[model samples]
Target: MELVTDQHKKKAKTILKWLITAGIGCLFLFLFFILSLWGFAKIQGPPPIKVPQTTRIYDANHYLIGKVEHENQNRTWVHMDDISKSLVNATLSIEDKRFYQHHGFDLKRLAGAVLADVKSFSKQQGASTITMQYARNLYLDHEKTWMRKLTEALYTMRLEMNYSKDQILEGYLNTIYYGHGAYGIEAAAKYYFNKNADELTLSEASLLAGIPKGPSYYSPYHNFKRAKQRQKIVLQSMVNNGYITKQAANSAFHAPIRLVHKHKPMNRTAPYFQDAVESVLQNQLHIDQKTLAAGGLKVYTTLNSNMQKKAEYWVKQVINPASDIQTAVIAMNPQNGAVEAMVGGRDYHKSSYNRAVQAMRSPGSSFKPFLYYAALRNGFTPSTTLRSEPTTFTYNKGKSKYAPSNFGGYYANGPITLAQALALSDNIYAVKAHLSIGMDQLVKTARKVGIKAPLADIPSLALGSQPVSVLEMAKGYSAFANGGARVTPHYITKIVNQKGETIYEWHPKKEQVLNKAATFVLSQLMTGVFDKKLNGYSKVTGASIAHILTHKVAGKSGSTAADSWMIGFTPRLVSAVWVGYDKGQSISTYPDSGYAKKIWAHFTESALEGQPKNSFKPPKGVVRRLVDPKNGKLAAKGCPNARYTYYLKGTAPNEYSHRCYKEKGPENGRKKHKGFFNRWFHWFH
Candidate 1:
């Protein structure tokens, strides 16, 4: 019986030993399998993958305007040389002290960790070397298990063999995820310092190099106390490893964990102007969403921060916030299409609908200038007389009638100059002028003035009952300032890629639609109106705001039921200010004019403060001549009632060539120009 008991014990021991051996063999086989695969892949090369490139927008002077990024990280990439050698050395010492001495894993650390893990009830063990950390970062994840550790070891072996020490160190610095959306040491430095990674001091470098073991636990955002504690551990490890001195370690330990609050990556400085730049990016660059959002791009816009601040301040402090006035302000350089500033609304956070670019409210009387411009092109001048009267018109085959009356309804019935009617924004007189000049000609003239809206041959067009964007009207007004050289309003100045290559630079191409002579004469005549009526400069007796003879500025004021607008320009800056409600309703009553002139005056005065006090220079072909506005007659000093007005060269009416052939009465059969169907119609008209 004793011999049988001994035999049973011996068999049990043998079986137990065989089972242990089998398990050890299986684990070794698995490790060998993974290592073999890793080695094979390393011989082949890293798998192909698309690397994301970043983009940024900057101002004309290369000041950072905004950036495109993803994971909330605006990464400015750097090569290994870009960072200091201390950064790499510190990271190596802190992450894996025995990295250089080991193949991939340290057998001694593994043995000690295994023993400690076995003795400990809590199954926490760490055997990661620097190479193993790189392996963990690149491929393996936080499993906290033996199998994952084994995989990490195998991968680390492959990494060591595939890349050199410097390359592996570079990968560690770049691929290691730091807190605050930072993926690398370079980004981490910026995250903590607001400066480049290469700019880090020894203390800063050590602090950042200590984060990867448990970023959240060591993250400054989480708890500065814990971060300091972990940072101290890093300093101790560096000291124990002899990488840093005790004095250095002690100083670093006591140093304050001054963590910078990571800046939000957004170029919200000018939402409107920035949005305008994005529009151009979409159309010209044909960028995709992935590239725009995740590319870590820096973009520079054409906005001068100063001008943008002025525009926004006026919109906020003086314009909209003053009286629930929804204001749209657009300013640009007349020389080029670069938009200097744009304020779409009072607050972009409340609403992003760019009113300056999108809102097409009826330009009211502002559209009349184009009609007057058309007449100038078609042989009419400021001195040209249109019989101003209460007129009625039938439309839709007489089913509807429009008794288009002047704005005040009391017209100077006999005959008035086109200049006076335009200054006062006469609705009846402008409609009559439109009929005499032909609506087709008016539409053609509008296209020339940068009024791109589709035109209908309707009488209402003459009174500017057509809706036009404030941006369009502003650029249209620039023609008068620029002496008839039509410039299309543009927002985007240039676009740059992530590589600092200029994808596009905008050079505003100006087109001369109207002859220079006509533009100059029209500008002079419009300035005359401001001199007489709309000029807001009350203190200056002879000096008008829009028509300071010393400084030429010509513009038009317009109001729809819901909106009131004033587009004015100097030779250099063209500014358009629009006031209205976002929902298109009249919030302020008429003649209760809400900040039209005040805002205009404020903006103009403020905008022109820094610019050269230069006046508009009329182009070479303009010939200014005076004629009697009441009779379209060559003026004589004795006619006290007659007003002298300027006319564009060739636009003035031919002096009634046959003076004796002038018809008998005021209602005598007559016609004004060649387009008229009946000469006798004037009597009835």
Candidate 2:
């Protein structure tokens, strides 16, 4: 019996030893599997937690104008400390009760969830920890495929190995979509409760905590009863997790909750200005729309709010709301090329096509400034005379006979000074000057002055027949306003990242492109459009709105069959306005024809109201001479139509007009010409 007992003890010892050895081997295999997963996750790099932040836009005064709306990522990141404590507690209690205790996965809950899913013969029961869900949101798509799940698991492991529990929690709260185009807790709080995340009450916290499970299914905006039921479940979970007492949970569940009205947020102020800024960002800065939307950059624009408001106001006040006639206005600072105000269309909501920068219409006489400036560069003073008559010009080696008639067929019938031609917008005089200077030279000069639109080297171009945008016209005229320094139009002045680092800042450099004397001479000649004294066969083109000028303004008015344009500038500001139909329909209505001038006059006056009345100062190389408008000669005593005309220092007329003195002979060795056309045309050839 003793021998049998000893043998039994030895057999039991052997069995026990084998059992311990097998258990140890199984434990080692499990550790090896976990280490393999950890290695793979490490090789996959850190988890993606970069959240798309909201990009803000400001005016020149640093006042918030609006925020750029990226797809559905209406998120504003806040620190964990800025979130309500109750929200954190409620979220953790409902989302992952063992979030603090586990590294990334909770085995017990995962086992229970697997068993339940197996019993139900489906994968409906979820065992995702907050870290796992965050990984899924950040890295993988929400497809229920096993590959996505496995990828999510790897990312979850990566996040746990790299970031702290607090970091994971904060990122999770900030990135989760909460429906209604709201991403993150802060935007959700604002959309649902009309309050900030830090200001949420216990009831609000529990209510928001229940939304992430199925945002659309449990949204209070979609189904309040279901959302309340889910909120009750979240409150009970908090109670069970010891985050709140049962009595406290009950009180929170019954607390009165106020929800904001369900509507799309209307926080944007200047829609057209915002669109223009985006255009500059894409076209000039080379920042694509997708990156700009998600970059979280704070853009500071050169927009003056007061000027923008006045521009819009005048546009609305001028054009009838019932008509289809559209108007575009642009007010820019000529000193720096900063676009202070922009009105793209009469109504932006109806049509977003920006006429200010997009629509290319015939500039008519508005383009004559560039033509006359080119003439000035080619040794033509403001007092230079051209025969303004109805004449057919033989061009293309007599193959093309171009006949450009004056407006209403009213011409000087003899000769008119360059200033009077500009004031009356004489087509014949413009064509002669354009042909005399060589057509291609005018195109080059226009481009040099910042006119980027394609120009045709034709005789009609002299009469402002080329199609150009209002913005290009404004930029072209900026050189004249700023004393010959060319400037590029700029909207955004600075761009800063979310980290308060400046990514871009505009330091405008003035490239001197035009002759200072020529630009000044042309600028002063432009003022003749308002002077009734320069009116010859017809009144000055700007005569109708001349009474509205409160200060010195040099500008021109242009009219085509389909388009009407008024471009002018003071020393500080240049405004270009265009009024026409979207489809090229001739402006037949009297009111429609006058819209450009009215809008320009009102907006310019209002914009310069509180500012100094600055006058255009002539450059050093320019000389002022009192000259006769009828003939390109120096004024003598008792001259009928003598006015101060600007000229390049050496180009002022030395020969006194025969009308001044009854004698027509050589004076001071200056021989008198036989005929005006014979001598002037001879010199031109």
Candidate 3:
């Protein structure tokens, strides 16, 4: 028995020796791995701690309009002293009770989390310490891989070695997202309560502290009830962790928290206009999205606050909100292309699709001015007559037949002057002119006047069958208003860096596109649209505007089955209004409702109230001649349709009217009319 016992003891000793050797080897391997990881982390260095600053946008009057954060991370860094103590306590109590006691991690909490995850067969709990969270947010991407976890551990150790406890807490608080596009305690306080972080009360702080765990799930703006319930949990954690007394926690639980009901004021006064300006900046500066968001730019736009307000007010008053009709308005200086006001849609909060700049719809008869301008370039005068009758245009060598008719099949069936036809929006006359001058000339004319949409070389181009944006229409009409100068529409007048250094400034480019005489003639012809007697038609397309304001104005009205448009301009300002449904549904079957015209009149009347009234200045080459409207000839005193019309030099009528002479008896015979230039010059003097 003694010999057996000795053998057993020897076997046990051998097993013990092997076990100790294995354990030592394992320990050495573990130490080596840790040392290697630490060395690698040291070589990698700490992650960048820079937080993106806010970019502010200002209007023409230097009033704050809006703000954008870097990469949508709306964070504002705050020091430890600037943050409320309650927030720190609540955050630490719920997130990591042993935050200050641990070097970089809490092993006890980590063990519990691992066990729980194993039991659930999924990672349902996170035991990351505040320092770990800060390390991951600053240094590592949010990945749940084992390699990522190891890297995070190394980064956490480095963070703990470098930063103090308070600094780690401040960094964590500032880097964490708190929903509603808010990152950091400062942004959370402002977004949720419209107050500063230091001004947050206990209830507000607790609520904000609970959001970092699951920002979207516990967002007060999305689910207030869930947020409050989470707040109760955070308060209980604070009590259990001894950060606050039970009584204090209870008081906070019952404290009434007044959350901001309305959307946090982002200072966005003209969201649509700001969007346009941002797009320009992106293209002009060749900036990426990240640079634009956090670049700390001070964008000075051409938005007039008063004009924008007037536009919004008029839109709300004229259109019913419940109708779900989309409307867009753009007002700009015709001389410089400085956008004064812009309304992209009816409700920007509901839908941010800017119809003014993005939506491409048919301009309908509003496109006729470009067609007429082409005709004028081809030797067609305002007094030149065309037969306003049903016409069939052949395309593809008669494979396609397009018969164009007037609106409601109402045609004069006889010759009509170009001015009267344009004022009346005669489809047949426009189509005839389009065929006479060819489609390329009309397309070129539209392009010169700032129509950027793709226009087909079809005959329907004359009747506005091509789609274009309201902004383009406004810009195109501005040529006539500015005496044939092509102005590029722009919103941002200047852009400055954060340090108030001018980085970019807008210089208006005035390109002369047409002769001043042609532009003036067109402008004068458009005035007849507002004068029913001058148009000599039963329905003047834009006559409604004449009753609203006494100022001299010229505009055109356009409509399709699904869209309605009214674009007008004075010498100083050009504005356009479009009303339609997003789904391409017709507004009303009746053409005379004139909803678009009424909205335009209301907005323009208010917008142009204090502005000076100016008229188009005729260039030196333009000559005024009194001619018979029936024929392009000199009129006698008794001529019925005699009116003073403008013509380019050398384009005036050279022959006297024989019919008018017959009506005025032999006293005004051809012999008496000899040397007609001398006689007319004497009468004019």
Candidate 4:
């Protein structure tokens, strides 16, 4: 029995020994297979995917625009130039000490890490080398299992063999997520210091190097204490590894952490305009999103950044704050429709709704000028005053009433000259003038003068009750800009690609809107609004400062209960500004003229600071004369009501067509009698 048992035990030992030997052999074969497969993978290489090219935004002048970053997604790209060697060394020391010296599977490190873990583990054991981390990031899970370990090792070997060191470094830096919407070192630097990564200090580099292990936990924005602690670890590792001196490491560790302010995108300034330009360029010109975002495109835009800034500032400070105010501003070169600036909102961040290009607010009194323009085409000289008193008309719907009241409260009765009616913004005068002149004619005249909105057939249409864009109003006013020539605001002057080839070029075309004579009379009459009706500004008056401010200038003010707007221009430069809230309601305690005028003053003052004031040159077609403003006829000497007026050179007044007429010459036109309505509407006149 003893012999039998001993024999069995011996046989079992021998069999087990053989099995163990075979198992060892099988293990070696498996490891060998893995190595060979990994070697093959090294050659085959990981596939390279095209990262979404970052898009860069720029100012209107075509300078570098900021980048568009994605939140919680890898949206940044960094290069070797943006990282420091010390950062690399520090990361390696605390992560895996034998990173550079080993193959993918560092057996020695595994054993050491395990031993340390068993001895005293604070948290996760450090068995992952930089290459292993990269491999895990590219492909694999962070599971604590032998299978995951083996796969990570295999992938690491593949990564090391497939990619160049620089490429690996770039990918690692760029793909690694940093908390606070930062993806790469460059972005992090911009977020932390308002600068680029290449400009970071040694302390900053060390602080950032510590973020990857636990981004959110170590973020300076949310967990400053943890971030500082992590930074200390990184600094200590750097010093111990001789990447940095003890003094440097201590200095870095002691440095205060500073987080950067939010970078509100510059893409916001003229979102609608930019959208229009980019869409046109992309659709019509075939430009792609990649080139638009990161190609360092120098888009020489028609926008005047300063004026645009002023317009936006005004809307924000003076308009949007009002509960119900909404406004828009569009300044263009009337000679060629190049829009200088367009501001659509008070707070773009809060809401992207654009009011400038998209809103449809009623024009109110602003539409009245088109009627006068039509009347001029009908042979009514501005010197020909009709009446300023309240009057009712039956038009539009026969049953509906058309009674427009002057916002100034009262009106002048019959015999009020055309010049006086306009200076007072008389609704009755405009209604009568347009009714006699013809509504269809008024619509055509308004269109020719740049009013692009659909007009009502009713008499109210003559008073600017139609909704119009600030851009359209600016163009309408431009009839006086270049002697009746049209101005159309357009963006995207030129579009180029990465190769610098012009994909598209915009050459603005200015057309004739009104004849020189009509334009001249309107301009002169428009300028007269400043005399006394708009007088008493110790230093400023919209009528006087907008037109004849040491130079030939002219403009008009428009206001609706919900919005306040002003469009003014000099012969050399024309600037139109609008101010109000996003929602169209009565936001102003008073009216828009005051606020709009002030904003206009601010914009014009800054924009026209250095340029020589310009004067309007009456087109060769205008005739000039001085006459009794009471009637469109010649006035007598010592006539207190005399006023200067312009007529088209070929269409001068019949009474004064022989020569230039001045008020000083001629017999007494009529017995001068002071009128009652003039007391308030035209106090000084």
Candidate 5:
């Protein structure tokens, strides 16, 4: 009996020793895990929370015109005060019932979730509080792994320690994705209900609050029935949490939630202009696309909505939708170079290629004015005679030859005054003038007036063989209208940051690049292109349409086999229009009275409707003289054909004709010239 009791006592002692060892090992393991968790929490501070914002663009009147959104992340941050109380209550009830009581995680919910998962034999339950979800959203990936969860927990603790409860809620609401390209509560509200967050009703709030759980599964836009089911669950949760009465929950669940039936895609106003502005900002400010997409910029442009509408209307009216032809128009304040209106194409939705600034097409005879301006600066008068007969020339040491002819092969074939040559758009005369003035001088003149296209020294450049954009042409013509002052075309007038601080403002730089007197003389000569009756010639050029309006204007018309252009200006506005196929096909089937001139005339007339009509004021150092149209010489009173011609002060005709000054008898009918010089001049007369 003694031996059996001793053995029992020994067995009991061994069992107690084994139990103590197991407890010590378990305690050591717990201590090590706690230490490691503390170290990790200390090391990992917080996660980066990116609240993607949309960049907005406004017109001159400060109306929202367009928005640039980040890929799949359209967010608009709203204050907690602006958020609906119903949405907040619903979110708290569904996501975390004991959010206010917990520090970073709910210990009771965690234990319950663990027990439930163990019972189910799978990780099927989540115990994440609002703070923990926010931490995971901002800092850690949503991976079902131990390391990710540990990091998420550490971030949650840091978030709870640093931010208040309201801040945490705001962050979670703003960072959560509600599907359909919406990344914030404000965006989601706008996307689903077409209203702001503060304006959401109880039904709408519950529906939106339930979306974040499984955006794809609960999106009202995608699956209305599923979304309604989830919304009912949220309403029940709100009722169970005592946030709302059972009666209110029942009313919400039974209420007809009017989900927006047709989701209206964001409509872009003046998309081409917006594209040009974006390109300008990117290039001039050295702004990256990423930075631009993460927007907070307030760009003020020079677009006149009224004028833009007019331009767009005229573009549609002139071009048939079935035709392959495309058109571009640009209008500007000639005095300041502000681009008031621009239409890059007929439909910006089909294509975004900005024809006004990007397309480089030949200007045709529209380029003649630049050559004439150069000639005028080189001591050539409007009355200076040039042989307009068809001609040819050899260049490049006789390796190349050019023989340009007049349109329709209709040549004057005689001495024609500079004014008549320009009015008729004589190709031979233009090439002759370009050659006489030197190609280098012509290119320099073109450059001074804002033609940025590369122009070769070839003679065809006089006829606009080189490709130039409509914007460049507008700027070049603006120099003529602005009295020879070169203008740099620009759209953005000012830019403000999100903080309401001015970050950029435009200060125009005007340079007087052409002689004022010469420009006036050149402009006066171009006016003859629009004259109803020039001595014996009838109005036949593109400027003939300008004669319909009472406003005084000067312009030129140009056409190639494939392109047509009209660039004109008044004292206030300068506009340019181009029409052609996108692939540079022949538009020769269309007449000179085609889309280009018609659109230009209609748009210019509409743009200048309410504005004052101002005439071009001639500068000093210009002289007017009466010359015989037949001979381009000083006119006598008895001369049958005579008109006033413009010339620089010292460049007018120095010789007078006495052949027509003599009185004639009725029998003789006309006076006869006896002198050799008079007879010689009589041949041309």
Candidate 6:
């Protein structure tokens, strides 16, 4: 028995010796592998550190309109000096008590976390130091796997070796995600307290420190009671870490915290406009999405806040909220083509479709001015008479016949002058003119004045049968208001980079596309829509809203089955208003038919409130003469209805009205009826 026991002991001792040798060898191999990784990390610096930031937008007056962010990551980086001490201390206490003492990994906390995770049979415990967390945030995905952990461990060592303690902490604070679309401490401060990071109080700091643990659950905006409980735990941790006294910790926990009002969280005052500006930045400017998100570029737009407010107000006041009718309003500067105000739809939250730039609807009779401009350029005068009776004409070499009637099926049934036809929005006269000038000339004329939408060379084009956007109409009308200088509609006027250098600037694109003298005569004739004396068989299209005019304005009104448009302009500003259903439903003729005119009147009056009532200045060689609109003949004292009519130099008729009597004047009173330009232009010279 003694011999057997000795043999067993010898075998056990031999096995123990071999096991010890193998264990020592494995430990040495592991150490060598770690050292090799450390050496490799030294040669490879950190990956590019690009933190997402917020791009702020401002109006023409430099007032903040809203902010733009990428993927809801709203972050604004700040220096360590800008952060409050309380926030830093509270964060450190709850997150890592030995943040400064440890290099990268804390063995004591790791051991405890491992033991707890083993006992609970789960991998829910975390022992990441600030440096380790920072590395994970910057470089690695947050997937709890063995491979990811090993990668994270390698990155942690690299961060500790390359950066100082303060650098690591600053990066951690800026890159961490908070609740409610806020990605950094500064953004959290602004979103929660409506204040800056340096202005946070002790209670506010504690409240914010508790959010990073579970942003959605501990958000005060989500659950106040849970947020308060988390704040108390943070305060207790601060006291235990010796960063704050017990008395101060208790006081902060019991103090009342005020959060920002839960209203307008997105700050989207003009969401549609913001979207249009972003599209221009991406598509037109060729700016990539990634650069736009983090480039910190400042976009200065031409939006007038006062005008925008008025546009929105009038739209709401005029259109009933319960109705499904959608409306779009666009106002621009006639001289520069700056888009002063824009409303895409009735409500932005309900729908984001921008009708001003998107919806393509017919402009109705408001498109007559473009046709008339084409006529004037082709040697057609305002006194040119056309038969207004309903008639069918054969075109396409006798292959097509088109017959159009005036509104309400009422026409003069006789020859009518162009001025009276335009004032009444006569369809037959426009069709006659469209066919007389050849269908292609109107298309060329429309394109020359900035109408970008495709127009068909057909007789129906004369009555505004082609669909176009409100913005296009506004842009086309700006030419007439600015004496035929075509302008391009644009939102952004300048863009500045983070280095305070201007990268883009806009200069007015004023191309002279129409004859100045002809345009001046056309503008004067357009105002006949409001003149009652020119009314013959039909009321002027603008007669319903003429009493609301506080300034000298010239414009046209148009409508189709599904659309109603009132587009007009002054010397300084031009606006186009449209009301219709999205599904192309026929609008009622009574109240729904009148919404566009009312909105236009109110918005135009409000937008031009503080400005002067400036009149359109006629370019040289344009002349005005008093003549009867009924017959387009030279006016005499015996004429029943006489008014001042504008015409190109030498285009005025020399023959007197038949109602005239023999007068004691020079050359049968022909010299007494000279054009206004004959006196005004020569006198100035």
Positional deviation of 175 in candidate 1, in angstroms? Answer: 14
- How displaced is residue 561 in candidate 5, in Å? 0.8
What is the Cα-based TM-score of model 5?
Answer: 0.63
What are the lDDT scores of the predictions, listed in order? 0.68, 0.85, 0.82, 0.66, 0.81, 0.85
Worst 10 residues of 2 by lDDT: 663-672
lDDT of 1 by residue, 1-685 (tens): 9999999999999999999999999999999996787677578564332355546667767776665433346456578898866677678777777777777668998888889998995449887777777676555446577788767666766777777777777777876767645777778887787768787776777778777766656877767778777777777888888888989888867766566654654447777777776666655666643445445455656687777888777666555344555778888777665678888888765666788898877877667777887877776767666676777977666787778765445666666666766776667778777777777888887787777876788898887777888788777877766767787666556655556676666677887767777776676666544554322112111222444233445667767677777776776888888888777767456432545545665667677775565575656665544344445555333332334455555555666323222433222223353345555565677
In angstroms, give how far residue 230 of model 2 lies from its true place: 39
The residue-by-residue lDDT of candidate 5 on 66-175, one tens digit each, is 66543335567798999999999999999998888888789999999889988988767889999988876665546566677777777887787667899999988987
Tens-digit lDDT string for candidate 3 (1-685): 9999999999999999999999999999999997886677667666567455567888899998887543335567899999999998899999888998998889998999889988988765778999988887666556566688878898887777667899899999987878656778998898788899999888889999999888768987767899999999999999898888889888998988888766633446777888787777766666544345555778888999999999988888887666778889999999999999999998776776899999999989999988888898898988788887787878767788889878878887788888789888999889888888887999999889878789998888888888899999999999999999999988888888767899889999999998788888888777768766544534678766688867778788888888999988889889899988888887674532366788888888888897776556678788888776555577755566566678877777777777666666656444454586867866766
Please report how far candidate 3 places residue 308 from its true position, in Å.
1.5
lDDT of 2 by residue, 373-466 (tens): 8888887887777788889998887789898888788878888888889998999999999999999988998889878787888899887888
Least well predicted 10-residue stretch by lDDT in candidate 3? 665-674
TM-score of each: 0.58, 0.66, 0.66, 0.58, 0.63, 0.66
Model 6 TM-score (2 dp): 0.66
Candidate order by lDDT, decreasing, is: 6, 2, 3, 5, 1, 4
Residue-wise lDDT of candidate 4 within 1-685, one digit each (tens)? 9999999999999999999999999999999997798778777787454334444445557664333333223355667776666556666676666666676557887788778877875325767766777676555545567677777766777777887666766677765656555766777777777767677777888788888787657888766888888888888887787777899888878877666645565444566556556655556666544344434455656766676776677556654354444455676777777777776655554554666666777776666666777788887876665666667778655787777787756654556667667766667777888888877887887777667688767787767777887767777777677777876667767655545776567787768767776877787777665555322112113553454244445666666766666666766566666666555556446545467766666666566667776566666667777665545666444555456678756654556321123343333443234356544555557
Candidate with more favorable, higher TM-score: 1 or 2: 2
Worst 10 residues of 1 by lDDT: 534-543
Ranked by lDDT, the better of candidates 1 and 2 is 2
List where candidate 1 sits over 4 angstroms from the true fold.
Answer: 1-54, 68-267, 294-300, 320-322, 395-400, 533-550, 590-592, 610-614, 626-644, 650-685
